[model samples]
Target: MYSEEQKMYFSKNLLDWYQTHKRDLPWRRSKNPYYIWISEVMLQQTRVDTVIPYFHRFIDQFPTVEALATAPEENVLKAWEGLGYYSRARNLQSAVREVHERYDGVVPASKEDISALKGVGPYTSGAILSIAYNKPEPAVDGNVMRVLSRYFLIEEDIMKPSTRTIMEKLARELILDGTASDFNQALMELGAMVCTPRSPHCLTCPVMAHCSAREAGMEEALPIKKKAKPPRPELRAVALIEGTGEHAGKWLIRQRPQEGLLARMWELPHVEWATTAWQSDEDNQEALRAALAEQEQIGIQPEDWFMDTEHIFSHIVWKMKVYRAKLGDANRPSTGEEWIPFHYRWVGPEDLQNYAFPNVFVRIMREWQEGNEA
Candidate 1:
């Protein structure tokens, strides 16, 4: 813990450093609560460089809370297509709609009120209240945690609730008497630029002299962390089925179920690897044919289909073998399964921009496009 005078001095020195060295980010240029709220939510677990374009495009499309509230969920989801964590986008829309109806399209000014919104937690509420409304509240995120831990030489595991309690207490105690917003931003900026998670640049830190961790030669080890969980493995097989005749130019794309991972997103039909027995290519094809016949009651021959390719996720490795099959002369698929018409939408050489696909899908599309180009 710091003496009141030491806290004030540290806050002043950090703010001075920030005034001279802070990056001129787009979000920093405005005090509007809506814009600040949007930027804060988007920056969660996402880098500034990645969020910039998304921020601009999103703001342009929905300039105000009212605009966001009025926009269709599909259009909002489309705009947020490439960005992962689809739940954030959904929560954002829900919050905006609530604000429009309940708050008269005005974001709440108090921390309690702001925190009441869907997905808006203590940190987000503090950020909006202090940064946008100049309220005297501290926004204690990981960055703030690092700075506080180093300055106080705290040794608690940052993942633990007790550590968060201690950090928040210290943060509230250290906030400058009337400069809480600037003080919080300075701490965040200092952590991001100088008191980094890795080798901290203590020599350049404005409050290095006041940092107990630096003084004790434990700057790198002050903020203890919890061990991470092991990643789970999964496998999937995707089918790139094609249509014939007028629909010949299209391919089948189905919307994912509204629950579970990647909910409501469009994807090619797929089967879990565990659900099917692993077999040779010929055997696999026969198995797939039989499954389709039993499941969709499709009477299609397997010889007309050709293998496409595969993809993988963070925890899952997919050994997908895609099969391209041309439909018969019949307008209706012989299979009882719904044959949603998708044009071969040939994402030709440079024509892939017409499709808005997820990053994983985009990677696969690129590979297929490159093959076509070659």
Candidate 2:
């Protein structure tokens, strides 16, 4: 536990600094709980600079809770195209639908109601309640934890749930009367701007004089974090299936299954390999042809290697090798013994924007487009 004088100094100095130095972000312009909710979700594991445009576009497209709740899932996914971790977008829509139906389109101020919504965790719930409703709840996130750890010299591993609970309790106690909104934001601001993960700007930090980590020369090492396991690698073979005749200047794509990873998102036809041992171009193409025939009942004749790329997720990294290919027998159903799957589609350059694609597929398509134009 920290002394009252130390807590008071930190609270007063941080609030004073924040009033004059806070960034003029778009979300800060209003206390609308919906805007606060959207910004908090967008800010998770994403930088402010990267989220600004997406936030603006998202708000313009779905200006109100009712508007977002009523929008189609496809349109919502399209709007959230580039922002990965699409589960956030999906959960947001599901929760907003609840708010529309149950709460009369108003974001719930009570912790129990908001926290029960999909993807509305403690940090997000606290943010919505305090920033939008001016409640005295603490919005403790990684930023706040880092700031607290260094200032108070708490040496617990931040990755642990217990440490987070302690940080939350301390954060709540720091909120002075009528200052919860600014105080929480100020803590987050200090962490982002001064008490950074690497070399902290101690001299510029308002609470530096009382920072226990700075006093002990451990500012960079106070908030310990356990390293996460590396993403497992998976080798995959992708087919850039080109179209001919009536379907000229187009490529084949398909939507993923209704469940699992990247659910319902469009992607180029591809198959995963069990091992990392990469094969020769000809062998890889043969494997792709055979795999496509076996998996989707589609026949293909690979022309040549197109490119190699990879897409990383939190748990897996897909190392993809793409090959240019054409339909083995477009006019007949005998080649692979069946019709094209219902989820497949042939899309030209202009049609690419009509479907929502994972960023890796988008990258591949862009590269193909650029090479063709050249």
Candidate 3:
């Protein structure tokens, strides 16, 4: 338990340090709740450097709440291409639409009103309320938890939900009147820069003088978190079907099913194998051919092998082997049989603008483009 004097010193010193050393982030420049919300969502489990370009482009494209609400979902997805975690984009748009319609394009400032939004959770609600509205709310995230645990020497497992509640209350107590915005951001900044996960530069940390973990020489081990289960790897075989005849300059692609993982995104045709350690390339290719023919009614004759790659999600990993192929079935829309009926399309490089893809697909396409250029 931290004393009143210690908490006050932590809050005052942190805010003062932040005022002098805070990074000049674009979202920090304005008090717009919408921009702040978008940035915070994008920042989760993502790096600051990676979010910078995406943030700039997203704000420029949408510009306002109404702009985002009115824009087509496809357009929004295209803008978010390669920024994995497609659900974030979908839920954000859904929530933004609510704000536009229900709140009259104004972000609700009250905790009850903002917290009720579609994707706004405790952390997000607190962040938006404090940073955007300057409310005395605490925005406790992984970074905040780490800093708090070290400063107060809290050894509770942060992975547990109850631990978050305790941290939130402690964080709220540390905020000075009218300084919640700077104070929260300061705590976040300190964790990111100095009180880092590994080899934390405690000497440069703003609240180091009163940091309990530092006093006990346990700064590196204060915030204890349980290890997560390893990702389950799935073996996948992909058909890099190239178009021929009038469709010579294009390649075959398919849109994923609408309600599952990586939903509503464009990707190459592939089939998941039953096991990670499959028999052989020949067996895998034959299985892919049979699966596509039976499942999609699309025929293909896989020829040579292409490059191999892998993509990782939170709980699953895809280890993929790409193969070159040409469409053997003339079931395409242009070839007679009805294709409205078809979820696949032959797309050229120029047509990539019309669709969004996961980062793995983007990497595959980039590699293909480079190969062609070379």
Candidate 4:
């Protein structure tokens, strides 16, 4: 643990360094709690560079908590499209609504109140209170953990509860002259720029002389973490089923069930691939016909379809095959399915701009559109 004097010394040195070297990030320019909250939430498990554009776009779309609260969920999701982990978008909406309704459109000032908001955990709460409100609280994230472990030569696995307890105590002890806001930002900056995860620039670190891990030649090894679990494997067979003329301009799009991976998102019609043998083109067509009948319950003759692509995802590889067919007199929406009629002004490629599409669909659309343009 860091002594009171040592903490003060470290904070002062780090803060001085930060004032000179801190990155000119947009979030750092303002002390608004709402802005800080959005940046914190977006930065979770995402790179700083990646979060920059998203932050600007989100803030422009919803300048205030009330704006975010009133915005449709679909618009919010659309704005957050490329950024994965859709739950964050949903939780952000919930948090905005709560802030508007309960807090009179003001972000909560107290740590407890901020922490009570949806998806606002201890780290986020700490960041808001310290950076926005100037409260003397520690925002102990992975960056801070690395800096602390190396500074104090801590050996416990960072994943362990005991390590967190010790690190939090040390952070509190080291806050400089109650400049919690600057001190917190300074430490975070150091971790990001100097005391990085791999090959940290120790020679340039402000507190290198005091870092025990550096002195002991174990700077790279401190803050040990537990091994990660193996990724789950899954297989899916997606169909790029197309419709007949003017209808041919659009394709069938379906909303996924409101639970599990990619919940409440739109996707192409797909099914699990069953092991089967096809000896010829006739056999392949027959297999496609039977699978579509069983899954989509659209009984169709094999003669009316053309096959076309395949796509894949991490942990879930897809063997996608496209089939083009015109909506014959027999082809219509069965129970539980919606047919975007051809005459209803097809959702033109440009109109798709406002909808939140999964990355896979986005890629497919890009390739398809490019092909047509070419």
Candidate 5:
């Protein structure tokens, strides 16, 4: 248990350190609740450096809550393309739409109202409230957890919900009067810049003199977290269907179903392999053909194997094998045209920007483009 004096010391020193050393991130330049909200959402499961450009581009495109609310879902998804976790984009738009409709284009300042917004979890709500509105809310994210664990020498398993609740209480107590915004940012900044997950720079830490973990030489092991289970692997066969005739310059892509995994994002046509037991390339090719024909009613003539790529999500790993193929003549009618499905489209290289794609599909498109240039 930290004494009130000790807590004050930690809070004071951390804010002083942050004032001098905080990074000049673009999001920090404004007190606009909307920008702060977007930055917080992007920072989840993503790094600061990576979110910078995305932040700039996103804000530029949808400068106001109303713009984001009115923008096409595809455009929003396109803006968030490389930033994985498609649900964040969807939920953000949903929340933005709600803010537009319910809040009159204003970001709610109170915890009660902000928390009710879809996808605005406790941490994010806290971040927006404190950073934008200067509310004394605790933003107890992973960085804050790491800093708190080391400073207080707390050994709680951070994965547990109970531990987070405790941390939140402790965090709230540590906020100096009228410094909630800087104090919370300082806590996370210390964890990010000095009290890192491994071999932390205890010597450079602002709260090092009072850090229980540093004094006890347990800084490296203080924040005890259990390992997560490995992603389950699924074998997927993807068809890189090229176009011919009037659609000669384009490649085929389809929009995902409006619900479930990577919902509404553009991706190559693919089917999961029922079994990874193909005896030969011929068997694989034939299986790919049959699956597409039966499932999508789109016929393809598999020319040759293209490449194999792997994408890992939190729970699933897709081990995909891509096949180079052209629209099979069987799918062309005697009317001398290809029967294009409503959901599928022939997109050329220049047309790639109009749709949002998961990173895996983006990689495939980049690879194809490279081959074209070569």
Candidate 6:
């Protein structure tokens, strides 16, 4: 436990440092709760540099709660195509729609009311209330946790919920009379810019003089976070099915089922294989053909292996082998047209922007385009 005077010195010095040293972030320019809400959601599991342009584009497109609420979900997904963790966009829209209808487009000021919104967790609610409404709620995220764990020399695992509760209590106490907005942001800035995860810049930290971890020479290792389980690997075979004749210069793409992982995003036709049963490329091609034909009524003659790529999710890693192919003769109708399922579309390069595709598929298409240009 830190002395009250020590906490006061830390808070005052940190706030003073932040007043002049904080980055000129767009979200900080206004106290608009809606904008703060969007920025908070986008910043989750994302870097500040990456979120900047996305924030500008998103705000320009859906400038208000009503705009985001009424806009088609496809447009939202398309705007969020490359950002990944797309469920954030979906949940944000859902919650915004609720705010538009229930709160007349105004973000809720009370913690309970804001917390009730979908995707608005304790941190988000705290951010919205404090930053936008000047309420003294502690917005404790991973960055804040790192700062607190070091400044106070806390050695508990931050991954545990009980540890988080303690941190939250300490953080709430640190908030001065009316400095919640800048105080929380200061803690975050200190953690990000000075007290980094590795080789913390202790020489430049505003609160380094009294930081308990610095005093003990354990600044870099105080925040004890347990490692998460590694993602399980799964083998997948992807078919880059090219069109023929009048449909030349196009590739077949399909929409994912309306639910589950990467829900409703577009991707190249692919089939999964058990890791233990994985076989050679030729056998994999045969499996891909049989699987597509039996499952989706699509037939293809794989010409050769094109590339190998991998996408890692929280729990799974898809190690994909891509093969170039042409539609099999059976799928060709006598009218010189191809009969694809309704869910599938033959998209040319020009039509790619009209649909939302997962980042992996976007990478594949970009590679194919670059290869053609080369």
TM-scores of all predicted structures: 0.85, 0.97, 0.97, 0.85, 0.98, 0.98
Candidate 2 collision pairs: none
Model 5: ten consecutive residues of lowest lDDT = 274-283
Give lDDT tens digits, candidate 5, residues 1-374.
67887788899899889999999999999999999999999999999999999999999999999999999999999999888998998999999999999999999999999999999999999999998988999999999999888888889899999999999999999987789888888888888889888889888878888888888988888799998999988998889998877787679999999899999889999989878553466778889999999988989999898899989899999998888899987778999777878999899889999999999987997898899889
Model 3 lDDT per residue over 1-374, tens place:
56999998898889888888899999999999999999998998899999999999999999999999999999999998777888999999999999999999998999999899888899999999999999999999999999999999999999999999999999999988898888889989999988899999987878889999999999988799999999999999999888778778678899999899988889999999877586677877889999988888888888878889999999999999998888875455665652422678888889998988887876777787789889
* Window of ten residues with lowest summed lDDT in model 3: 332-341
Off-target runs (Cα >4 Å) in candidate 1 are 275-338, 341-357
Off by over 4 Å in 4: 273-330, 333-346
Q: lDDT of each prediction vs. the true structure?
A: 0.73, 0.91, 0.89, 0.76, 0.90, 0.91
**For residues 319-346, what per-residue lDDT tens digits would candidate 2 score against the true structure?**
9999999988742565644357799998
Compute the lDDT of residue 307 as modeled in candidate 1.
48
Task: Give model 2 RMSD, 1 decimal.
Answer: 1.7
Query: Which regions of candidate 2 deviate over 4 angstroms?
Result: 334-339
lDDT of 2 at 319: 94
Candidate 6 residue lDDT tens string, 1-374: 67998899989999999998999999999999999999999999889999999999999999999999999998999988878889999999999999999999999999999999999998999999989988999898999999999999899999999999999999999999989999988888998899899998999888888999988989878799999999988889999998888778889999999999988888999999855566888988998999999989988999889999998787888999999999998787888576889999999899988899888987887888889889
Q: Of the candidates numbered 2 and 5, which has the greater lDDT value?
A: 2
* True-structure RMSD for candidate 1: 3.9
lDDT of 1 by residue, 246-337 (tens): 54434555556678776676665556655544666665666666665564444333443344454434454556665544443332556744
**Root-mean-square deviation of each candidate, in angstroms?**
3.9, 1.7, 1.6, 4.3, 1.1, 1.2
Clashes per model (N, Cα, C within 3 A): 8, 0, 1, 1, 0, 0
Q: Candidate 2, after superposition: displacement of residue 211 in Å?
A: 0.1
For TM-score, candidate 1 versus 3, the one ahead is: 3
- Measured on C-alpha atoms, candidate 3 has an lDDT of 0.89
